[model samples]
Target: MSLRYTFINVLVSIALLSSCSTPKGITYMQGMFEEMPQEIIQQSRITVQPDDKLSIVVSSKDPELAEVFNLAVARHQVGQSITNNNNMQQTALFTVSPSGFINYPVIGEIYIAGLNRQEVAQLIQKELISQNLLKDPVVTVEFMNTTVSVLGDVSHPGEYPIDRDDLNVIQAISKAGDLNITGLRENVLVVRKKDEKNIAYRLDLTNAQSLFQSPAFYLRQNDIVYVEPNNMKKRQSTVNGNTVQTPSLWISIISLLTTISVLVFK
Candidate 1:
């Protein structure tokens, strides 16, 4: 081949190779977008825990009769009054005892720990009917302190309320603010309490199947979800006190090599 033709051919090959190569910037690695698992959706069940405040309201056709049973009776009052002791009057704040029982008005003590809100409500309704306190009681139980914390690489980092009983890890992350581009998908941390012990779970959102089998997929009350930033973010900020910048360094090297190749070829 002629010198000019060979030179042109070489330049074209270089350009094609460079084009196929990843750009010299933050590259989003594959295996990040995962589908919702069916089994996870089916088996995501969380039970109540001690020290969790629950709001129980029972209503009947006869409002007066319902109110009578719902009244704050002396014998059923176990915890110090939030109004008198803490100077706060929150009706839903019923602290579950270490024994898993709650001292509800008129109903006395009912064991509710390890039960879901719906389960507790149904149990209360059954109790009211069995005791003949009301003809048919409409009981509603709500968690007052169903809060989850999301920190690290989130738009809003802090505590958020979990309105529903079945909140998955991804939903919790969205609530805190969806993960940033630099957020690490393989090392998302879930800090939760299980069997009275604090447990930390590392979840990999990159794999589509990992969340399906993960026990930490279901978020519990007072659980903390943390999304650590990728190496790019670490170099940009003083996050976690580590000054490592691997992503940035890789991008710089790649960009320099690309620029040098284009100039030499031209």
Candidate 2:
């Protein structure tokens, strides 16, 4: 074969191989058998933290008796004109103090941080019974402003509210429209704040065992999940697209090959 034809064949082969190459560690929960081990499966719960807003409601057999224990709804005029004004009522939200205490209607200050929603409800129920305020009180507690932020290499990165108590890392990612193709699944980062200190944990989505064993698997309120971009993606972000696998590099190589072909023929 001629030298020019040999060189052209090699370039075409290289381009074909590069185009066929697929990224590794993209599939999640790999190496799973028919049934997962019971020990590996863990249940996670959401715990209340400082600065969390809570909505606590107390109910009893008698509606009138329960009304006093619950926070009264705040009402405000909606329209600017007096004739067209409408009264709008909104649920009163209780912000947990930095010291983990919330001022209840009659019970005053109650420390509730680190407790789950059910535990908070039980505590309030006990308080009402102990104070002889309600004979059969049923208290319900819910997180008002708890959310987790998902950023970097996600389809739709944003802050997602934790609607349920047991929102896991997988679910949180799904909420953000899952990670993009260029996301680095091997080293997904979860940043959590506890005791005024920020702690970071890395989880490998490719390994089910490692992901399940991670403490940050169950995301907490205000947690941040960051999916770092792969090496190729990082390179593409640069002005020059500095990588042999990049499209720009491939274009330059094709241009060089075309020039060599013309010179060889001429």
Residue 255 in model 1: shift from native, Å?
11
How do the residues 1-266 of candidate 1 rate in per-residue lDDT, one tens digit apiece?
A: 25545665565576557547863323322334555445544556667788887777778899888876553433334477333443332344578998799987777999988888889989989988898888989987788878889999888888988878788888888887788877887888998877878899998776557665688888888888998887667766665443333445545655676566656765
lDDT of 2 by residue, 148-262 (tens): 9999999999999999998999999999999999999999999998878999999999888778878888888999999999887888878766676667789688879967886
Q: TM-scores, in order shown?
A: 0.71, 0.82
lDDT values, one for every candidate: 0.74, 0.86
Off by over 4 Å in 2: 1-19, 34-43, 78-88, 246-266
In candidate 2, list every pair of residues with a backbone clash: none
In model 1, the Cα lDDT at residue 130 comes to: 93
